[model samples]
Target chain A: MSERGKPNELGEYRPLSYFQLMEVSLRELLVEKGIVSDAEVQATLEDMRARGPDAGARVVARAWVDADFKARLLENGTRACEAFGLDVPALRLVVVENTPQVHNVIVCTLCSCYPRMLLGLPPDWYKSRHYRSRVVREPRTVLQEFGLRLPEAVQLRVHDSTADMRYLVLPMRPAGTAGWSEAQLASIVTRDCMIGVAVPDTSGSE
Target chain B: MPQVAARPQYPTDHPSVPVRFAAGDRVRVRKTFPLGHIRTPFYIRGHSGVIERYCGNFPVPEELAQMRSGLPAQPLYRVRFLQREVWPDYAGRADDVIEIEIFQHWLEAVKT
Candidate 1:
């Protein structure tokens, strides 16, 4: 019933990659084995599709406004995320706070195991070989290419997501945004900021 | 069917293999490339650093990736390495550093 790839000469569409074929075959086998229903798989796919950077932005905005919530978030990221009704099951979420002295950046050099439940699928650059290999080695240059120039005094700490855990950067709140509402604040906290490539823009530009 | 979720706490208290290093302990990553799925990056191999914190015990990813029961969870630690040590030609501030979560099996104690 899918309309994705072009039809083959035999009037049947084929999967593009072996992985795709394997996934389809596995799904069919699981359904046939009564392990999982097609409806359940479809619903899970829908849930994944609904997730995006907005969820992360909302969490960041709340942390910026609520001091108590921020403490809880820093202590236990997975538990605090539940306050926003975001349940990150299966994986541990580690939130590294970006302070005036310490700047935090994240990378998964082995594979793209990101916090997809909160931030959705990672950007292409996050999964790119160049970004993965270079970020850990030359974080300053990589961040600079992304237009983030850090002060000489600030220490850049790159966290490599290489285990069963995922990381999210708790970027410092931008200055000159005193008494701003959570919604207004969330609007400027871009996805790259949470990933630690950039900072929240106080200029209010999208 | 409900999604298969991983338990939050993997059994960490393995009696045979006690956690060797603690937070603030100096350590070095063993430079070895076992033939399997490894979570440790190549850059950190054979590098020296201080254990920033004890992350927790988790199933060995190498076995887990192959659908095998990676039992007897190993202690995972966040090791902090100086940027200059990691890359001699690193152009960032001398104070810059990187923290990597490496498993105990891949780490060896440094007497510093």
Candidate 2:
């Protein structure tokens, strides 16, 4: 059995929350009705847990090195990722490139609709109401909170993922990194970089 | 016993509504709100913006939630609104903007 929600020092397990109880009931019903096997559900959960931002990082790294790939990625993100052999099934990805004049960021004002297929799951703060509400209202301030201070001249473009589309920020490649291998470049393309909250730091890569 | 059919799969290329606006066209989001699963954000309602790009068509989310065929699909566009226009006290740069994906039904063309 999973050790989730383990009891405290008293050795007594706490009751499941309302949503947790509902989830359990639903899962049980689905299994009982043969809609989905327990093994399939468990495997899916494992698959979700196994996903990480490496796929996204590699894509960014490839974009940095290959102009053709970058053009394809910018024009059709979903097709480019698929052609790259990444499993982006049914994902209508919209990639926003960041440049010297313009900076791009993403926020789902309605809810945390992130590019999970590429970047894995979203961070807790990304889902928090604080980030969701404030990011769209005052993005600079929110970005500042994340230690990303943009120059006054850089125009900020905040994307609200409100509908059938998903967004990924293509952060500008930092300077002083010449002749770097694709793997080395990908190492710096962290999850936060793709999410637009943070940029790749060259200082840590070397 | 009656025969049951498999769940219908709505193809992404299914017949959709005509695209009204194009890139660079000025448009305004409709302010009206009806009770249902609406994808349009409340903050963008009644605001004017420029069509950044046409993102193609997809099933209407409102109808999808009601267990109905959301067809024909609706044309969606990425509308770019100036931050200052959206929030009067927006502290970001004057050129700072926010873009949202809105369906055709929620947008009306803005006269120059």
TM-scores, all models, native as reference: 0.88, 0.93
TM-score of chain A of each: 0.88, 0.94
lDDT of candidates 1 onward, in order = 0.83, 0.88
Where does the lowest 10-residue lDDT sum fall in candidate 1 chain B? B1-10
Name the TM-score of chain A in model 2: 0.94
Per-residue error (Å), model 1, residue B89: 1.6
Superposed Cα deviation of residue A71, candidate 1 (Å): 1.9
Report the lDDT tens digits of candidate 1 across residue range A1-206: 13435686678976557866677788889999999999999898888878888878888999999999899887778888887797777757788899999999999998898999889889999999999999988888899999999998998999898887788888888888888899889888888998999998887543
- Which residue window of length 10 is worst by lDDT in model 2 chain A? A1-10
Off by over 4 Å in 1: A1-4, A7-15, B1-16
Q: List residue ranges in candidate 2 displaced over 4 A.
A: A1-12, B1-11
Task: List chain B TM-scores, each candidate.
Answer: 0.84, 0.88
Top DockQ: which candidate number? 1
